[model samples]
Target: MKIAIVGATGLVGREIIRICEELLPHEATYTLFASSNSAGTKLKVNEKVCEVKELKEENIETYDISLFSAGGERSKKFAKSFLNKGSYVVDNSSAFRMEEEVPLVVYGINEDKISKETKLISNPNCTTMGLVMVLKPLHEKYKLEKIVPTAYQAVSGSGRAAVESLKNEEKLGEELKPNYRDGFYTRPISRNVIPLAGNLTENGYSDEEMKFVNESRKILDIKSLIVEPSNARVGVETGHGVFCSATFQKEVDVKEAIDVLNSFNGVQYWEETLPTPLDAEGSNDVLVGRMRKGLSSNKILNFWSVSDNLLKGAALNAVQIASYIVQND
Candidate 1:
């Protein structure tokens, strides 16, 4: 396979490069693409230093697949251009996720949705990807009815600027004020938690919150499923931890639920080896643990799920989708 990674100089894009090298089948060639500003920059992929190339329409038709994490606008502008040229676009942006034509896929949960006709497949939000892995097995057995989720998302979810802000803030000592450009977080992300993530819409749900509610339904194929989520930003470098309480259609057997979750792919129940941000640091699985039943509602349950935002959340998911397309098609 010949692969091209767009946004190659960004954090998630860089991780995609690492994953491609780590997961490549023995016979494969990789290419790195970035904006002109980063064109001459050099990156090390599988021990070799490769220079980034400028991304232009004329040069976009040379690869079999493109994994993108640049942002919505860049994807909106160029994804179809690549797809039209027969390059499968596994997008990591929010742009095409909800579109009727695009399939929002999480590799273990719903990889079969992919096909040759599905040119631009959207990867779900990082938080959604981690949560759905745990939810899918339970939903399949008990039929999830309602969910209340609160996310303690890390600074890496905001992008490279937020990661650097925490480092700079650590040097100075206290929580500083937000300085628009260089500081990626909208508010001071140092020693405090920010209640907001993404833009706030008319319904009062931040775009990040809506992604959890909306994308969960799409991935689960349950449009009427109720998901109440509070998305917040915390001062962590990696890993988005979600504290979720969910209700099922029937009273779930706690032991059976636990056993089923333990059996699910990408879940970390039986093996202590399941990756966390540090273990999943460069890998693809979502880590889950500490499951319990709500004392009051027979149908309700609680659990914690964590995943490296750059990997399971973005890059790895994109690559997994691309790999699924190739194998299944």
Candidate 2:
């Protein structure tokens, strides 16, 4: 089967290649595409060298599947072309995720949303991906009433440039200032935390914050669910974490919640420990810990959820959706 990896030169794109190598069928051949600047780059997949091609209309080709990690604009421009050519698409972008017709799927949670007849699937935001993995079991056992999530996202979630900015600033070692505000983010991102993640929308919510609110509701199939989120960017390079206080319609039991998290396939629970960014880095499963009753409420459940933004958060989730299509097909 012919497969295409759009944005093959990017951080997540390269990660998709690595994951597909590990997860997808070995007999499947890959075609790589990227922006003009990265088009000629060569990447290794399964010990074979593949050259990246410029993504353009005339170059569109048919494939059994296409894994896209390019940003929204490119997905909006080129994803349909791949679909029209009979390729099933698993997009890792905010674009097309909320469309009325497109299914915003979190594999293993709502993977049944995919059918053999379905051609396109959308991956949720990295933070939302990890959040819902933990939330799904809880929601299944107890009806979800609301979620208040404060996400501490890694710089790598913003891509390679953000990581570079953090590294470059770290070099200031002794020279770093308290008000050192510059570079890719609105404020300094080294040895510090920026309370604002994405650019704030008119409603005073950062785009990233709103994404958690919207994507969670959609993926969990709870349209009326209330979600209040605050997103912050941290100095760490990878692994996004969300501290959530979730209120459920039914009374929750801490032991039962621990049991459910432990039983879930893609989740790991640290009953005796809490996970940090370093602990969760390089891990595919969403690491969850600190389960307890929320302040003043038995119906409210609190927990910490974390995952590798590059793996489960972006690349793995996209490929998992593609794997679902392949299996069901």
Candidate 3:
């Protein structure tokens, strides 16, 4: 099998390569592609060193599958070209996610949505990926009526520029002043949390928050599900932590919910121990804990979940999709 990774020099792109090396280690041939500015930079796939190539339409046809981590605009422009050439595209951008024709997929939750006929697949936002992974099993056991999810997302979700900004702010320590006009973030991110993540929409919800609403609906195939999302940018360097309170249509038993989450694929749930971002940083599994009954309703359930935003949220999910496609083929 031949595969190509677009945006090869970016943060998620690099993770994609690392995962591809670890997962599809033996047989697949790999190529790296990035923008002209990043082209010619060297990157490693397993032990072999390869230089990044410029992403172009002509070059896309050479691979059987292409994993795109470039931003939405680039994916909008180039993804179809790859698909037109008969190469399946697993996109990690929000580009075609809500498109009626495109399938928005989470590897374990709804991978069965993928079939031989699927040519273009959209990966959910990092926040949505972790939320839906834990929600799916619970939703199956007791149908979901509503979800209130507040995310403590890592700076890595904003790409390398935001991560650099945090590092620069940390180096300056207490002396660091807010550069509201100059930085990529709206406010100082180091030793701070920004309540708004992504741009605000007309409805007052940030795009990142709405992704939790819309993408979860699509991935879980629940069109009428009520999702209220509060997405925040935390100071952490990696791993996204989400605290969710859910209302189910039926009465929920805490023990039963814990069992369902623990047995579910791609997720780990514990009763006595709780998961933190540090535990999730390099792991593929979404960790869930701190399960308890809601204050007001017996039907309500609350829990905490954490996962590496770059891994399970983006690169690893895309690679897993590609692996499933290959295995089925």
Model 1 agreement with the true structure over 1-329: per-residue lDDT tens digits:
77878898999998888778767664566677888999879898777777888888776756788888888888998888888877888999999999988999998988888877887899999999989999999999999988999998888898887788878875655436555334566666777688987789899999999999999999999989999999989877888888899999988887888789888877775234433455545446677766788889888888777888888898887877776666766
Candidate 1 least-lDDT 10 residues: 269-278
Please report, in order, the local distance difference test score of every candidate based on alpha carbons. 0.82, 0.90, 0.89
326 Cα displacement, candidate 2 (Å)? 1.2
Q: What is the TM-score of each candidate against the true structure?
A: 0.92, 0.97, 0.97
Question: Please, what's the RMSD in Å of model 2?
Answer: 1.1
Worst 10 residues of 2 by lDDT: 174-183
C-alpha lDDT of residue 318 in model 2: 88
Evaluated at residue 106, the lDDT of candidate 3 is: 90
lDDT string for model 2 (97-192, tens) is 888778888887988888756688888999999999999999999999899999999999988888888999999986878777776787888888
Instruction: Identify the superior model by TM-score, candidate 1 or candidate 3.
Output: 3
- Quote model 3's TM-score: 0.97
RMSD of 3: 1.3
Top TM-score model: 2
